[model samples]
Target chain A: MAGGGNLVVTVSPHIKSPETTGSIMRLVLLGLLPATLWACVLFGISGIAVIAISVITALFCEVTWHNLRDGKGTGRTWFALVSSLVVPIGVSAAGLGRAAPAAAIALMSAFILSEAGISRQGERRHSFDGSAAVTGLLLALVLPPLVPWWIPFVGAFIAIWLGKEIFGGLGYNVFNPALVARAILVLSWPAHLTAGWFRSLGIDATSKATPLMLAKTGAAADLTAYYAPLLLNNPGGCIGEVSAFLLLVGGAMLLWKRVITWEIPVTYLGAMAVASVLMGVDPVFHLLAGGAVLGAVFMATDYVTSPVSSRGKIVFGIMCGAITMLLRVYSKAPEGVTSAILFMNMVTPLIDRSTMPRPFGVVRAGRGVRK
Target chain B: MRVRLIDLTRGLVQENPLLRLMIGLCSALAVSVKVENTIFMGLAVIFVLTLSNIVISAIRPVTPDNIRIPIFLVVVSSFVTIVDLVLKAYFPEVYARLGVWIPLIVVNCIILGRAEAFAYRNGILASTLDGLGMGAGYTLVLIVMGIVRELLGTGSITMMGVTLISLGTGFQAPTFMITFPGAFLTFGLIMGALNKAQSALAERAARRATGSAGRPTPVGGV
Candidate 1:
């Protein structure tokens, strides 16, 4: 009777039981399902195989490393493994069948090793967090399917180790781990990673060039051709990256679940659209091409690495979109989303610091510096 | 003899240029991609370090303190030029591979660091021993890093155009290892491990000296 009369209240900096890491990771996985299913429908068994191999390898590496280092059996390892493995497979499967096996194996191995190695040395192995796997998957998806497998591995390693762990794991990292992996991979293996594109579900996939690639190389192919396949299931790039429609569906689910906010995706897409129009390029082609939609929706809006405040998120999104277009149009590389995300990741700290919410009835300390 | 021995031993651990002082990292990271390059770099460093130390020590008293840096550079450059010529003439392939890095030996902080810190203050013989010891330590680290990077990146160990060992066809070289970022990653991890090892060794030594049970000591501390 006395317990029934008791009242409990929670305030700001409140420990409201929101979504757990596992739950958020699960949602991200769920969000990816549409794109993954689409990839399967297009690419066939080989897509499934690459995804399976990447996921199994990532899970095995994480669990084994955890068990060996921690000296105790934690059942939570399975959850982490599942989350990490699924993301990469979904992403990679989006543009599978074009990449070489050796390259894939090497890249994935490097990625897993880097994540595991770095986590082992630090406080509490966050390798089981599913973040690294998501990073690897997203990176693999954006890369041209014909790339050496080793490129993803290297990218994964850089993303997890340098991008995440170096700044202190998971929540501490300022940049999106997936973008970090993709950026490093693109920089290191530019030739293989950006060589060609593949068609989703096509029987005889060949060296197909993405619209962005054609634009960069001055190919006179009509822009409509690129836009048409992108709207459907064109496999000229990473697995989850090919179909703009699938990406939008998955992204919409994430937005609806509040897994990610609309600020980043909206501003990023908006900026890119404006930039594309200004550049005299078709805005729709830019939006549907490369890793723009995947990056803006999934990679750029990562909860841990992105800004907290609504305003900060907007700034982050604008910068990501602007830098992406700049890199795509001006830079030598065909895809700019990875670099854009990484570059914005580097600036996220400053964005957060400047954009912190003001106190009640109090003037903000450096109003001039406020964006 | 004891003083010279002490000087020699100092570079091995107490002030190991690579591990403790953290000097001469450019060549260490850059040329340590291959075992052969590592060996060549190590020998070149030893030659440059030893000769510069001896020459600098001999002229220390006559040299002005203000112009010491420039004078040190000149001496280091002269020795590096000689090494560069020798490598180019005899080990043409190594020279070709090492490229600008061989000339860059003059700028290697290890040689100049020893010249300014130890050689400029010590006797010729003592400086010579110190240089050799420091050179050996630097060489050891370079070789270890080289072996690690080469073995992982390429999955094989080759020396002077000879494949000494192969890890079979499955061993595919991570091409990243041949790039700049790979060098940084290898150097960083190796440095971290070396830092851990040095702290562990110091703790053991401190316990032995004090006749007490050794506890783990923090790195970069005595």
Candidate 2:
């Protein structure tokens, strides 16, 4: 070594935490599983299909982007990319029934080859960690379960490539990748994204407006009837957002595990409750509806996008709640959680800068410590 | 003549008005939604730009330094007015689609920027070439953007009621590609791609300069 091992010239924050990104991501995934399983149970095979497609596509994009960026073995990378995509496209174009089987085989083979490639001594890590999976699952959770097979595939691409990778990959992204994908999907295909909800498990399980949508037009569901449904199942909203009780349970698990701090979620829900009441609406219903619980417990507390300071987290959470309520009450859109978290994500840097804690024993430069 | 050719070709790539110079973007963003609109808009800009450059260059000696901006504006406005009137009279449909932008071209920074930077001191020939080159570069970007936005946003490209290419009925076009944010996104992506290509070209040139052995062991190439 140039300066010997003792004189290690490394970057700042000399101490290190035991938690690797992989470990933390694993915990995060574990936390999200309850709500995700509930979502699958509620939305059925179509829901599981959406989740699988999104996760697979997300993992694909993550690896593909990394390989392309590395600039070595680019020919092989391009071949892999084209071959994986062409098989499906070609299959469809040749009047073969469904491209799904071809796509699955091609993608699985690509993943296996990539896994072997990364297992070598010095290859890029590329989706070895579970962050991409978490993003994919989060995006799937936000999407309505009944969208065409292609929707989640496209969304996973957007979430990974546009939302995360384009912003210098995971840690530097300003917004939650899942939320960005969901919001863009909504904006791009309102007819599909808005109307694909599978609500209230029964005869007419799909195509009905969400309770929040109906409430916007002044036909509030019976409070007691909705209370149990919204908490347990079949609140007729986004896939993972159907069971507020399950989401809450997951949120509590994450909090208890100390994976996420209480500042953002607590303040967010508290503020939402207060604001909803002020606006003459039921806070409990508002909290259960749309993406409120999912966003507060998961999206807003994102380690990279959210503020570092506890005070900043509180401020961010309150602003998110206030904006969520304001958008729900005033804006044309029935759901506000996605936009609220996204908007606050943009403001996170300012919150962090302003909320920096003063160093111990330090006084203002203009004033003396004695004074 | 060689220098003059360089001046003529430079703006078409290296010193492109919209991408490189980054001047006159508002009009481009506004009018680059349809392939036909871009064509008409591009033509109008080239006409106004070249004539204004010629006029400004011709009058450069007489024009006072104290109020050069105002002089440039007057010269630019006269040319823009001609375009405005001509388009409104002949291509009324394009004029309507490009509404406020035609008038807005008078205030476009590219004209004044070139007048101040290049045309104010250059010969009429050089200024004329620069103007044409810059205008062509701008139009190229506009056409590319129009094709991209229209093709993606609508699943097809149509120019003057003639369909060029359609992605068929199954294609679910993302409407985001047609919106204002889409304009910024497209512009950014194009710029990023150009940067990537330019860097690659520079790297190849460096490799050639280093020697035909092609090992590229010079500096950090290894």
Candidate 3:
């Protein structure tokens, strides 16, 4: 397995594993499936449409970039295209009740045409695997369903371009691409991103404030009503963030598969719970509201952006939760999960540096040298 | 004469103050939200820079080197006061928008930098040309940035109370483009584009000089 890598001559007792980047990414995608599908089911056609556009656009960008650069496409690129195209259409048609299927078909067709136009200049094949699709899916899940169609298109492009590629792609990215895109979009159009929230299940399809917003305004009197529907996945919030239960389920799948460890998420939620209690709010309600669960499970534990050492990861999570609560309680913005996670992403390297373990049998010299 | 012309033209691109030399950015970024304000600011800079350059160059031969900086400050402040009074009297709207940035021009690094770096060593004519060139370059960038910020931030471009272009009712403008961070983003992106374009031109020249079938680098590789 290590044969393909640059072999650095080191001390003996070498170990190797068959796990590759593509394999890990596929598992991550599998873990995300439940929450994504639930979001589509609750938000209906528009939710699916957003996810479809994002995923296809992401894959299209990756493949087009490679094709233009290398003049050939890889096997994984074709697989990514087919999967990004087929999965969203199938999920939307099956889950979305009584909405026109034509919209999905038209979107997919247009995307295909775009992909064809992009790849026509090259004769070579490229590989996309599932990383871009995962980023696209995650980005869609965090966005409000009431946003205009073009928002996702623009967001996905920026996510892939600025968030991922500009940092030299995949393992090199400092921030989670989806969160970066969301942050940029939110900053660019606060009215569109933060104001327009659709009720879940398309039940009135009317725009309403998320529970976090209500909490911020102190308008949510019935705290029980706010916490009751957390499991039902029918609340006023971003498409996937509404369902705390489903997000937990997906997170558990990742934990069970060992795609992600429990350190970051556990510490993150624990710290958030403590902060909520300290702030005189119900801990469980705080845990369930906004994007706390989604961000704790998905964004904070990102392999590239999160701290590598276990101790560092715990500190990172605690800081993220604390900053998130501080912003929620004291800042003007109603929610702070995205910004909090991004802030932590920036500090992960510093955390890792501080927490690095000392080498065996090594000792430091005395405090000061003689002048 | 050709060397002097190069000195005059170099500031336009080869050594642009804001984008390349990176001086006088405090006023440039702050007052670039409106085209009218930027024009006034640019003209003020040109006036102050040119006059200060001429004064510094004329005094360099007679004055002691130790007190040159204080002398430069006095000359620059005198010219800045003139600009201040003129704008306050004639273009109060632009002056009002510009506010403290106009007075802060006395401390603007470009004016003093030209005095200390170029004017103190060169003749009066050459120093004046250098100041005009640098000021023109700064003004060009200000106008370009003003157009971008105003057009995107407010969906319309207005100059002296006249609407030059309006995106109309259907367009949704991003207000971030006129904010402080937006100014940095605009400057950074334009600078990056200029760097890339210049490097591409250099590579093409290198290829021409080589006169061989060298492997061609792809466009926009960076």
Q: TM-score of each candidate? A: 0.79, 0.91, 0.84
Off by over 4 Å in 2: A1-15, A93-102, A105-127, A203-207, A221-224, A365-371, B1-3, B211-222
Local accuracy of candidate 2 as per-residue lDDT tens digits, B23-107: 8999888788888999988998899889989898899889999999998998899988999999999989888988999999988
What is residue A256's positional error in candidate 2, in angstroms?
Answer: 2.1
For all the candidates, what are their Cα RMSDs to the real structure?
Answer: 7.3, 3.7, 6.2
TM-score (chain A only) of candidate 2: 0.90
Prediction 2 TM-score vs. true: 0.91
- lDDT for predicted candidate 1 compared with the true structure: 0.74
Worst 10 residues of 2 chain A by lDDT: A198-207
Q: lDDT per residue, candidate 2, A1-371, as tens digits?
A: 77666767878898999988888888888888998888888788878888888887788778778878886557866776677666666667778735664475457456635654654568554446788889999998998888877778789888998899987887999889999898888878989898887855663322487878877987665644566677878557788777888888888988988999999999999999999999998888888888888999988999999999999999999999999999999999998999999999999999999999889988866787663
Of the candidates numbered 1 and 3, which has the greater lDDT value?
A: 3
CAPRI docking class of candidate 3: medium
Q: Can you give the lDDT of residue B166 in candidate 1?
A: 82
**Residue by residue across B1-222, what tens digits does model 1's lDDT show?**
346477888877668787678888878888888999999889999999999999999998799999999999999999999999999999999999999999998888899889989999998899999999999988988898888888877889899779987867744455677677788878777766666677778788888887896564565632
lDDT of 3 by residue, A1-371 (tens): 47767767778667867777788788878777887888778778788878887787777666555554454545544665565546544555576523323453355446545555535557323445678888988898888986876578778877987788766678899899999899878878888898657776554323478888887888877666767676556568887776788788889988998889999999999999999899988778889988898899988999999998889989999999999999998899999999999999998899999998767765545734567
Sequence-dependent TM-score of model 3: 0.84
Candidate 1 per-residue lDDT, tens place, A43-113, comes to: 65545544544453444454444453465444544444455545545455676534444334544455545
